[model samples]
Target chain A: MSRPLVLVVDDDILLVAMARSHLSAAGYSVADAQLGAEALDRLDERTPDAILLDIDLPDACGIDLLQRFKRRPELESVPVLMLTGKDDRESIVRAFEAGAIDYIRKPYIHYEMLARVGSQLRIGALMHELSERNGAMTRELDVAARVQRSFLPRVAEVAGATVAQRYRPTTALGGDMCGHFIAADGRLALFVLDIAGHGSGAAIVAVAASGVLQRAINERGLDAATLRGELSAFVDIERTGFYATLVVCMLDTRSGELQLLNWGHPPPLLLERGRTRWLSASGSPLGVGIGPACELQTLALGEGDRLLLYSDGVCDVARDGFELRAQALELALRDEPTPAAVAEAALAAAASETIEDDDMSLLVLQREAV
Target chain B: MATQVIGIEQGRLDTSSGDTLERRVADALAAGASEVAVSCGTLALVDSSGLGSLVRSLKRCRAQGVSFKLLDVTKPLLRLLEMTRLASAFEMEHSSRSGAKTSV
Candidate 1:
């Protein structure tokens, strides 16, 4: 591999020659400029990894040159070391203020110069590595967000129900998810869950939670208790130190009987004939303090009944005082007896400026007369 | 609201009633300065815990004899204070000298 290039800028011919010799010996390619103006011209031709600059230049002061270099888009990230005659505190401070990475006094030792150069080079290499890592992570997050979004159940009309859903991630990818599957028996099984944390790890857990829920639904055949137990077991076995709050509901389309299981999740709001109440179940959040068996909450859904399942992110959206999220469900259902309208209204209520505290997901299900 | 300043550049320490920021404020107060001017400039990032720390420091400064004033409150820091309701507690000004003049 070719040696890293180091630019040497000074008005003194002897000093420039000495620096070139020392830097070349230390496995660095050396380029010399006698004045600040010449250095600027050379920078226009080829950018170097580092610059050894003299404070007093023939055409312009090194501090002024440093500022100019900082303003240039190309040279902004290149590290510069200032060489000064006096080691005064003010000058040293000024050098730093003007964007000098380090400073060396007049009549510098060869070892000290090489060491400082090596240190700055290491910093530059690390910075490049970090930038590349950040780029890769950004791309990965974009893909993850897309995949998480694809996993969500799109807005559609159920055979015997009206459905509405909304999902918003706090970060590029979030740990909140909601989905529904029409069982072979014509029962609609839907769930909303929030993993304990945010970011990529949390997203991973969210996906895992989804996988666990799917497997349980496939194996246990819509038994809410058995599915909850399986989900809790899966979380325990993973040992991710991450927990999830979930509310799963299986609505028997033929009978309109809703079997609900709430696992440390925000209670689902039930609205029927202008009356609102919470669907409560007895279970701890998955992988939390205790792993007790979840008790299913049974509710008989009348014609035009609406059930809203949400993550805590929706309820926790408050500015001055707590906004009663339960009330949001009532309002959403009151206007229209449809699930789509209810979900849209709830999202509108929780919408705010940038920086949402947590991810939000909602699943609204309405029972229609079959 | 409590405010404490440290270093020549007047680095700021703003806190409300809390235990987290008390130690940092006490250290600043014991440094033997009669009045400290705190500047919120250069405080690039703050988390929820860091906000708790600032509130604690303010309470400690008030317990001591030293006076606290906040200057150059950046937008991000101000937003944090607003979220926690600490912005209402302290007297904020553009500069340290102005902060002193406005104090009752």
Candidate 2:
């Protein structure tokens, strides 16, 4: 194992030199900093396992420096030994109160100083271990977040319709999911699901739902209602007790026919000719008993028509007893030609508010007027 | 803060409330309350964290054969639940009877 690194901070070169010799002989990697400023700079370069801080410095007091070190969460765990000449009970108490792990008096015995430093090094090793473990856990969540992103399609485009999406999870991994799929029959399938909760539990349910949707739409050629029923049954409320609100749709450009199925989700928007209309969900959300068969409503889409699908995280927040209504949602859709531009414009409107409590995802589909 | 009795006269139940609300719900389930009624009628707003806590609480209640209900949900609170598609997840004391869109 490599020797633990120790930083010795003192204005007196003689004392610094003495610490260097004692620390080096004790099998420690020593770095001497003659000024408080220099010591802080060394910390920035690499965190030492323990610090030997002088009580008196040209630029700052060692107690003040100790406060600064404690303020930094990353440096808080590192043991700091106060090097003082006063040896007074008042100063010693103050040093401990200021967060000094131990103290060494001026003109101290070499062996005594070595013992204090060694004790600190052992505690420092445990501190470093805890920090590393926390860091590893955070990295695992990051990796899982990226893996979740992979399950959703990046983009789906075809000759008649173009789909664009933007997804944001409240936590590193969230319950919100969205995807667009172009079927072999020239029908485009798009969906956005919001699980009741967030974090790993919600994320697991989202992944399973999205995975099934991808497979059913791509291979089975199922309709929106049938797909909804199957997915609802798949999530066992009696067992997992996890449910989701979702909007799933399939658009066929060949006959300008559109099929939509919604369960306790925000209504999708249809914008054309500077006008916007809401698409109806009108059914209880899934995992709530998969009640009466879902009704699939058919609508027509021609050139210049744009459809918007989103999760409720966009309008769940109420202002003055009113949340984003159809009129407000209509304004968000405005009129953008391409799916990318439309989603961009709409998301900008949603981002205007500061407080958001839910994860958000948006998917826009536009039929090429040309 | 005590967790056994979670009765808020009027306030916002949010992350700032910490795990207090969650603990109360857990205690209710542990005590075998046939149905735990969370009174949101006095609550002005609840953020996503609050909603998430409720979801977890409901799951716990279900595992123990208990019902989780939102008591006297206000118009704004009901709208929020509906928008999130959670209107059907938890039972509501006052339903379409009060012209409030909620699960019976």
Q: Which candidate should be chosen as best, given DockQ against the real structure?
A: 2
What digit string (tens of lDDT, one per residue) describes model 2 on residues A180-239? 877666688888887766788889889988888777777666565556656874555445
Best by lDDT: 2
Q: Which parts of model 1 have CA positions greater than 4 angstroms off?
A: A87-91, A155-160, A171-173, A197-202, A218-221, A237-243, A252-257, A287-293, A300-305, A316-357, A366-370, B1-104
Model 2's CAPRI class is: acceptable
Number of clashing residue pairs in every model?
4, 0
What is the two-chain DockQ of model 1?
0.02
**Per-residue C-alpha lDDT of model 1 across residues A119-172, encoded as one tens digit per residue:** 999999899899999999999889989998888754355777877788888898
Give the RMSD in angstroms, all C-alphas superposed, for model 1: 12.5
Model 2, position A297, has a per-residue lDDT of: 81
Q: Which regions in candidate 2 have their CA more than 4 angstroms from the true location?
A: A5-48, A57-80, A87-123, A154-156, A219-225, A232-234, A290-293, A317-328, A355-357, B1-36, B46-69, B84-104
- Model 2 over residues B2-92: C-alpha lDDT tens digits? 1122444546665544256777777676665666666666767765556556666677777777776777777766765665556776787
Instruction: Specify the poorest-scoring 10-residue window by lDDT in model 1 chain A.
Output: A316-325
In model 1, what lDDT does residue A355 have? 27
